[model samples]
Target: MSLYGGMNTAQGSNSCLCDLRSDTMTAPDGAMRAAMAAAVVGDDVYGEDPTVTVLESRLATLLDKEAAVFMPTGTQSNLASLMAHCGRGDEIIVGDPYHIYCDEAAGASVLGGISMNAIATQANGAVSPADVTAAIKVDDPHYARSRLLCLENTVGGQVIPLDDMRAAARVAWDAGLFVHLDGARFFNAITALGCEAIELANYADSISICMSKGLGAPVGSVLVGSSALIMQARRNRKILGGSMRQAGVLAAAALHALDHNLPDLERDHANACALATALTEMGAGDIQLGSNMLFFTPRDKNPDALRIHMADAGIRIGGQSPAIRMVLHRDVTDDGLDATITAFQSYFTKE
Candidate 1:
């Protein structure tokens, strides 16, 4: 059972439902709310918010970085990191399907005049070192200088192996490029790998960690790097209007999540695997299981009809076929998993 219980139930007419759309749907539990309410808050813009300061310091230590800056969203955190690393007409090497290239609204190019050299990513979510090496540009006026390489852990929920990360980072560093990790699902990857977070962080020059996703906090992401890099990122954050006042309320919730919810991410992963197994057994869809996420492609039923059937059963999903992603979080209970499996079973049976 979840400490937060069923969040979909609270949304009205969806009582005791399962929301598989995304882990971002999680709401803070009562314990997290209590922490928020009791948080010691000061103006964060002035860098006096004690809770925010603690959260940043703790994350910095956990990731073995010299400093960390808190931002309102993961998008802004990545943008700040990008802007801090690259200058006008500079480029970053990134995976084509990764969040920094596809989901972040092109803030680097739109706001900082940075270009992205998107390389093809492997099915395992790693960009090949050969591709990365080939992407680095020479110092020519006609070409954009490749200043940095951006990588994502758990890209599309698949954890990138530590060996692969090191290889890619080595390729970047040997070419005189800095490395940044979009680690929005850093803990999820850590949980699945059964490794310390610092192990992953050691491979990158900086990392952006989201507290709101599988960690179950309502908001906030942290950017961790060397003090000099963080100082630059802080300025970039301010330019992007990510500076917050009295942000400790949100930080406290993140603190609570780090303390209470992180350990349970493995449970969400187990539930995802269980759901995938059940879906596979029913011949409902082709299933791809990753840490706390499952992608299903219906075999016998129409995708739209399957979606409508699940929606009617109070089970919500996201994306369009050939694959629909279902995310598990702290808010999704074992019963919710059962309901989801049954919904799929029923949908396929009636076809």
Candidate 2:
């Protein structure tokens, strides 16, 4: 429908117009671009960007936190929050599959000098409270001080249950460890859980909510927490070279998305379900259909073969080990989904 063409051809057969590689692959629409163009700019380093301030404030209110700071990326936000919460040589308990552990380049260990202690994560992305308890270091001078507990919601798009979050929080509170949430796909989690964003935020000392993902902002994330935590994160952000001179333009788009786009996230989830179901019918592979993400192990495990096949057809998907990850986002339309489904069906039905 609105195929604002940026088609990059790949060497295969036919291709669908939909780009489901990752939400990060989404391009800001014309309205978002227009908002960015007309945005009031200021030096965020001096706290002078009116638009950035408003966006931060609004995010804080939505996340039910005392304050918020806009970050250039969710990775930076997560790293800054971790740095703000823990001291050097401190350990943080986390799920083995957490973005901080797997996706992010061990920033806590290399940059912050904080150690990560991984606990076995359940299929739903929740770490056992017993595992968290066992992971906490005792008051031994020989051990790294366990100072934080990290959790990821919608871990790879599978929503961690609320009770699991509460249990993890209780375990962390009992051990005097601050809890941090890597809520990169938090909107998906909130929509899936049928709860307010704060319901998840309340269990953690801080949250890193991504604007560039499901929210449809071109780029940016927001870290929300107590005023002190955010102030600390601000300094860490500067240290990490994340302080922007004219970030309000980006903030404006995030603001637009919060008002106009947040309500439509459920549609993306629906699209994901439809696509997942259709793929299952086509015998694509074993699919983990959760939230707005579908992780499927292709019947053909050759990554290069499958990637080249899909690319030739024009549908871009994220290749993650044995699983081919297809994410539904704000820009991918219903028509696009239908096209994607048909393309996959045709591919599988062929030799």
Query: What TM-score, over all chains together, does every model reach?
Result: 0.95, 0.94
Tens digits of per-residue lDDT for model 2, 158-215: 9998999999999899878899999998888989999987788889989998989988
Each candidate's clash count:
0, 4
Pairs with steric clashes in candidate 2: 12-312, 14-313, 15-313, 15-314
Candidate 1: residue pairs that collide: none
Candidate 2: regions farther than 4 A off: 1-16
